[model samples]
Target: MTDFEYLEPEDTRAWVLHPELLNTPAPARRNAGNALEEAVALAAALPGLDVIGSEVVRVRDPRPGKLFGTGKSEELARSFKENEIELVLIDGPLTPVQQRNLEKDWKVKILDRTALILEIFSDRARTKEGVLQVEMAALSYQRTRLVRAWTHLERQRGGLGFVGGPGETQIEADRRAIDEAIVRIRRQLDKVVRTRELHRASRKKVPFPIVALVGYTNAGKSTLFNRVTGAKVMAKDMLFATLDPTMRSIELPDGPKIILSDTVGFISALPTELVAAFRATLEEVLSADLILHVRDISHPESADQAQDVRDILESLGVNEATPQIEVWNKIDQVDPEHRAQVISSAERAETVHAISAVTGEGIDALLATVTGMLSDPVHEDQFTLGFDQGRKRAWLFDEGLVVREDQTEAGFDLTVRWTDRQRRSFERL
Candidate 1:
């Protein structure tokens, strides 16, 4: 086995390939050109890589040893050599054998879609739990790729070892070693999950409804979150921009206070290992009182992308009964003619709202709709409290539930209109 770094220097020249397999079922095959563009964007997301070029390779007959036929493989090898490409990113799954063979033939490092995603996750995970989850998923992915003789299992940088290190010898990771690492990570992750559960439990006692934002990657979920909460989450025009979930308490206009959760964006064909590992992080969505399914209406493949998000939600066992509002975001990016059509279509559906988070267009109406959906039925009640019970009286006034107050000889008499949740909270106080 030969040991060598996968990537070199700070800027690795990279090429992206999206194989459009003609034999694949129509439902499973994505738009080849659009998929290629997304793959290029993903390559651009990583910090140290310089994407030189991209292509959509049409594959009529799949080859077992190498993904491409011999002549095509040689042609690509020549191009890679000429372009000085250090890495080739395939926008689909490649068998371990195929990966090894392609690397040997092309004389460059090969990363499949799963490995690239893992690398990005490793780079973007901020929280401790998120880091552990990405590590576990990377280990699971690396376990299978260990079949290749030139395996680089040691990390010399922030990202997972899938991308090469500088002047580092490749170390073969035995199954036992990988398994032990996984066990250690699982123990840490379990502790983190327990702590998160405690926090969630505390939030439940506060009577604030949770509204979770979920959508495909780079679909403006974080942007919408920032627009609504005024919190500076990393809202970028890149894939997997936000990895860890962020929560903020926000009061809807003339409505009940709620917790808004912005979670890691979903992607089409998300790695199964990651899906399982990040389940703990996504529990916020499962517990949400309402879900906002944000969509990039400007994207050509918007409908397909929306379906992909719905598929992931279903796989995560999100409650079908949970109320969902379709937020058609990025309307400003659409052409004026198309934008008008989008607005018209959204107007026809009560559950759908078309708005641009960046320009603040149609945001008030969306907020009003959210207020209406989250508002609970209110009833009037009278309460008598002594002057000494100032804290309870203050709580009612702060919540804006007091209808009227009258001073009395005993203490004070209050007429309040409040929801069941508020009433319960008041009793607890």
Candidate 2:
């Protein structure tokens, strides 16, 4: 079965299709190539899957009736018959009419890019809000594709012989029901947003800085998040493994407390419908005090993926305003020479850190640097506590990173620069 609880044919074969357009900036090289790679990766990631073959087609003039030319369609039909391919996975969004027409030609199940992403999200989402947001996005995406996608939905109606309780075709009924569900989900999502806003406001009152982790899918953001916060979040090699935003308190070497949030990873060619639906979730990134742009240094397309992430951030209008820290992750996977080049290049950026999340290398430096970046300029105060006074010493340890220590005759005299929260917590102690 697919991730969305959709039953899959055991003896099914899938042929991946891509439409090429030379006029646009995203031609076959950029769009089709990247999308096809991801589609094949997704197919491999699925629990149970069978792939007969994959092909890329370039249609000079995309027909309104069918996405492919007549000749190509006939070729594909013949190929499917010969190979017994039972499904077609299109890398681009398909209009309802185009989808219906294309399916008729192939006589098999067809899935579009949006549906595939939704199915992945349905499987990855863990929290209640996460599930609701995914469902909301899927519903919104489905609303438009209903005509071509959901022809299987049917409702039985028999009231007073002929004209009865609901005098409408099953399609119309399903559309109305889905519309109502969308409305309800939006209201629920509004509530979720308000609740999140309240939590954010509360954190603002506490004065702990909020740092959000964001990057392209499988960029090691979740792994870095786990490393920094000591939270056991699910960090896998697959795409879109972490959906919901998770926040945790982490202590810096200097004893400053910060709230670190791991957010949904961005992807190239993310559906516009989903972006609109998940606006509330993206708000967390916008409200962050610091944004960590994590990059999987080992990926072949890491730089392009970083650019894609920046483009999405720009579209969200949070790119310019948010203070950013560039985290080059997965140094463990990089070769020595390449890793040296990356590290040397990264040193030019003002707020860049290189680390390996798997090995915990350079993490302490990352945390210490973050604490230093967040240091308040208003004050410089230090206090000494005796080691014999365990409570006082422990209080000092929690409040600040020790800068200088003296093992005096009286006790352990320590000098520390405290974070804002550490100062407050220290006073209470």
Candidate 3:
């Protein structure tokens, strides 16, 4: 949680490398080029870093002390020096020893995928809970990397200290300090979580179904959310743009009112520390009455991205019985040839819809589908209740289930349209 700021005109020159392990199982490996591109994009998301170059380094055998072999490491060092690279971002997990050794050999700061992501979350987090979660995740990540100066831990700006500031005196951070910080953060987080739970309980009593939007990073969940709810959420084309859960109530056209939630986007190989830290933030997804699995249908690895979201959702323990609709978003970005095919495929699926959240294409049908799914069956019925049952009449009126009420000589005659669940509740009353 360092608060150090980068001086002007001294942006950190960075290089991104994705180590493509030859020994990795074919099914377990991602497209190295795509992975490198994603890493570059991730780097771009952070400020004060100029990503000058990136590549997929094919590694037959990874060195223990240094992730890359001696010759390869030396060659990369020379290239980094030639390019005036001040930071090296490895698009994979790196042990503390490996990271320290790489920084020593290359004469640059080294940040693995997990650290980079933690930094981004630290930067993007706006809410108190989000900031605390990122801090806890960073502490957990840094606890293992105590081999280097934990300057990032001392900054007030909440950065992980991977970018600049080279000549500061190295302060050896102890395990006890980080452990104490973790404990303190947990206490604060528990309070925040309790407050959030109180708010959630209040929301539950509002008689609106909660519909949550979930997707991979930059998959346009926020855009879709803003389009539907008309709320000015920060819908940026960046990784983890929406870090905290944002909810708004909106009445669908000719449909029931629902609480719509936009949640943090999922990514491939999400850091374990982050998953644990942000579980509370993801509780909104778990309690959702319905989930919209948004996808960037125009991306080349859209299917892979969707699977990653699903894997994260499953890990978060979302109920399998909960309904889900596949939202194939960003159709406007897809090519004409594939756009037709994508729309056709979605048309055949009962739970899939293809639309451009920006262009308003196919949104009406999607809303109609959501309405049909959330709308419960209703039937008209008449009932007579005496004045002694004033509480029951009041309850019926409060539920908006009463259509007409007529005063009778004995008491009242009521005509109501309600679902089976409402009728059962009335009978219980």
Candidate 4:
């Protein structure tokens, strides 16, 4: 008997299809070759698929019927048959009708960009909240494409595998099932979100400014995160390497400690499903005092990648007034001659820094910049704390704000040098 949970993944042969609209810029404004490369990388991120080939199909006008012209469709179908390709990954959106028609015409299981992203998320999510978010997103996406994808479940046989419920058609059952799953996942997700809010409130009591790292997929956010905080946070050279949000406290040289949050990487054409479902995770970005946009300076499409990150940030409601620093990373990958030019450009742009997270080159300057950005002009003041207010006094000293203390008969006299935020927290006591 086949176990449901441990079902083995089929090693299917796959080919990636990218429709490069020659007349229009892609969502990330990437050129055809770069777009195709990214699409292939996305496909490779998922397991159980041997991607044999990928191509850029240039189209002036997209078809609402088959996505590609009849002649091109027939040609690709012949290629698929020859390669025995079991799956075709369309690196673009497809209407339900077009998806169904293409699958029939191509005689292969087809996954649009959204579906492929959902699969990767489902596989990579580690936390409960991450899992629930991915599930809700997947369910929402599947709800739309159920017509073409769930045909296998259209069976009258009374069996366990993808069968309809009593007196219900397959589509009805699937819709109902999807609706129920979404509701169930949302219920669980709500609790997680609430707990996160409570945790955020708790973090407020700690009085550290939150700095969040955001970048395009495989742009080295995790690597920079690890280098800065000395935390082993899975710094892999892969797309969406870190799905879950991780936070750590890092102290600057001669400056106060701040919380640094490493978030999921932004991607070109991030699916609406993910954007909606991952809002809980993106909340960290919203609450950040500073956003560090790390970029792979060596990548050919780095400019387009930066634009895509900004676009996604806008969609997440990160306002224009928010403080963001551009970090031109991976300088180690650049040639010595070109590296000097990059450094010169970064020097010209005060907000941009050229650094290598791997080699720690230019990290001190970056940290000093971070310290400057987060520093609140601190002032020293004297305060009296009674014996009963030992907790408050301890909190002050624990924060490294207290410079000196004098013991008294009834209480203690403390001299504290701190920021406005620390002053507010003290006042709250």
Candidate 5:
């Protein structure tokens, strides 16, 4: 057995272990408490799982075989016995051997953080692209746990089937099932990607400056989307309320048209599988002329959540050169004093705006900021189109790119001022 290097906790080590040498570090559990709450929230969001109770188990010197110390494991087991808990949700990563060991000792089903997230994403994904991505991510994750293959759960196309009796049977893990499934999903996803590329190319002809709204989950992204676009999208105070991407054409205060894309909200420790799978989904952000990073200013972990969004953005290949605006949302929840302070601070920041999407406060300023940002270092050009080029002429007008036009006998002479992206789109057309 390889000796595991359980990080010796700083505080509470002397006390927790004097009681028992191998007791989980209390400080570690306290640090994990917030993550455990988030895990519980994630469980609550999912269907089919009845969460009885959840807590953080701090393992001081995490053992290779059992993870927790003998005493601590017995203590948790007693609690499980008393509560008749059916499933144990771990807030952190777990090795397969430790997972098997914990299940045997506790006599209940178990799901670690990554598995739980993957399962939730599996349940929530709607479109064909989303489904394929989930399957690919799940298979990739499951590949790691092939060491202990139990496949009693009936495979469902929609959900990652983690359902069954105490001791289940292993089917796919043995026959390179995941490998084959991954290959198939990749082939399908490739087609979807190509189709998306074509759609994007088509969108280029229309040439609407894309302004994508990104934020932490439950950060009022959907609510803001509805407020800005007057388009009713599902807005709820739930984790991952909006899964699929949605876009609508919205006009700025002064009438320049830009496309507003409401993207899937981000979260801390987003599953690697989901990230890779959904990168295609977030491809909207890549081409976005401006990225509006909406944030929940009221949440205690708002700063941390903001950092997580930044991390994911970088991971998804958002370049530093791309224009990004920080939108501090939910100021309506704050007191008047705090709200004033927030607005003042945002005003001073170069590319930050504070707004309450629900109350419509500060939204005007935010929109004006967006318009100004879009209009920076504008490009003006002229083109002569024949009578047959009415569609192209109409496209230019529709995009609000035409500054002046003179009808000539041959056709129309048009003067257009537009961004480089708009220019490129016009060229494609």
Candidate 6:
């Protein structure tokens, strides 16, 4: 089998490893440990793989050729041999040369954070766009790391060997191939983006105001969206469960229609490459008329996670001034008294919607608030439309809150509440 397609033996064990500098400050080391643990847990959840163990090693001196010093590298080699580890998973992005050197020295397959996460996403992606994005990210990541199994060669005379060595390096060939793949992927993604733009344009004319659900990974945004819209989007307790955005129509209490979109959850330090690759998916959040920022209020890092979501949104050039409803979700999991205290301390009375998505708690109030935002009056006009103009009536039912509709002998006499733009359209009709 080709190297890319070859699977590790079933009996092989995978080790999630992280390296820290020995002289690093205690607080920094502690954070590294936490990050390593998080990465390990995520790695362990990948299907068709067995995680034998995980560890953090302190390298006394950083070696340019390898991440660890000579002695530390020797020690790691011994540990790998003792554990019979078939794969070494690093907790950070590694350059192609570094990956090749590490695999050769450790005598095991090496995968850095980007590659491992890409592998898991490849397994979990369900939609066509999702699959394409994952493949594109993976190809972009692997293009640099395509080196031969080993790079050890005897020193040779100065003439042909010196000239041949630099030109024929496996790393260079891999990088060139990766560039080609990236070009192809970008062209394909352009098509996908154009198709998505068409859909978005159609949605704009549909007259339903869009409400996009967004938050940190595993923050219950999907759960809330599914509850409100009755969509069967995947709502697992894992990072990036819903990579592709999904939208469904929901009827409000006042009979007006609104579109609720469930988008890929945000995360702290999300890989830039993945973000660029999933631009088509994220455009949903960018164009949303309103954003619901869901939060797992019970999590210790909830505040930091919320900040991260804001940062990502800002980076995407999405207007922070756009309407946002801060939905403190998963409140049922917290102590009732604590939840009450949190709600009391929160200052944003109008913009905050505290509720537990898993339960039918406070959801009605939140939906009512969203519907009010959609149907709120920006303009008022009187229009007379013929009964045959069903499109105008339907637009009123969908985007505007109809106050009165009466059948007249000449035509249908209707009183519609809508924006000035809609009022103009009605006048033309």
Instruction: Give the TM-score of each candidate.
Output: 0.82, 0.77, 0.83, 0.82, 0.78, 0.76
lDDT of 4 by residue, 1-429 (tens): 865667677688999988987667545346778888888999888988899999999877888888788889999999999999989999999987787788778778888999899889999999999999998998898778655345543332122245554333766777887898799989999999999999987987677888899999898999999998999999887888899999999888878799999999989889999999998998988878788999999999899889989988998888765678999999999988999999999999989999999999988998888889778788999979999998898788768888999999979999999876567556645
lDDT (10s digit) by residue, model 3, range 30-65: 999899989999999999899999999999998888
Instruction: Rate residue 284 of model 3 by lDDT.
Output: 82
**Model 3: residues with Cα > 4 Å off, grouped in runs:** 1-7, 147-173, 378-429
- The TM-score measured for candidate 6 stands at 0.76
State the C-alpha lDDT per candidate. 0.87, 0.75, 0.87, 0.85, 0.78, 0.74
TM-score attained by model 4:
0.82
Instruction: Name the 10 consecutive residues with the lowest summed lDDT in model 2.
Output: 153-162
Q: Model 6: per-residue lDDT, tens digit, 1-429?
A: 665876666754888888766777764353566567667766765765577888887767766668777787888899889989888888876776676677778888877877777777788777778888987887766554444542442221011122234335744655666678778877887888899888876876776777789898889988998888787888887766776678888898874787888888776667677777777788777767778999988877688789889988888867754578999988888887798877765435887878878896889889888877666567555567776888867867666458887788867677766664355334433
Q: Give, for candidate 3, the lowest lDDT window spanning 10 residues.
A: 164-173
Residue range 99-171, candidate 5, lDDT tens digits: 7777778776677778877877778889898888888998888777644434322231123443433332444
Question: With candidate 1 superimposed using the best TM-score fit, by how many Å does residue 260's alpha carbon deviate from the native?
Answer: 0.5
lDDT of 5: 0.78
Per-residue lDDT tens digits for candidate 1, residues 1-429, read: 659757656799999999999999998889999999999989988989999989999999999878798888999999999999999999999987798778777878888999999989989998999999999999898777654344332231222333342332333435557788999999999999899989976875576988999999999999999999999999999999999999999999998899999999998999999999999999989878789999999999999999999999999988566789999999999999788899999999999999999999988999899898878688999979999999999988877888899999998899999875467557755
Error of 2 at 11 (Å): 7.1
- Tens-place lDDT per residue, model 2, 1-429, is 656776655855777776665555653256566657777766654544577777678777778878788999999999988988877788777887787777777887777878778777887777778788888888777667555334332221111122223433645665777789889988988888899889875775676877789999888989888877778998999888788888898877875688888888888789887788777888877766678899988878888889989988888878464568888999899999899898887777778888898999878777777777677554456665665578867646553567778787877777777655355435534
In Å, residue 395's CA in model 1 sits off its true spot by 23
TM-score of predicted structure 3: 0.83
- Which regions of candidate 6 fall more than 4 Å away from where they truly are? 1-12, 18-34, 57-62, 146-173, 335-337, 346-349, 380-429
Give the range where candidate 5 is weakest over 10 consecutive residues by summed lDDT.
12-21
Return the top candidate by lDDT: 1
Better of 1 and 5 by lDDT: 1
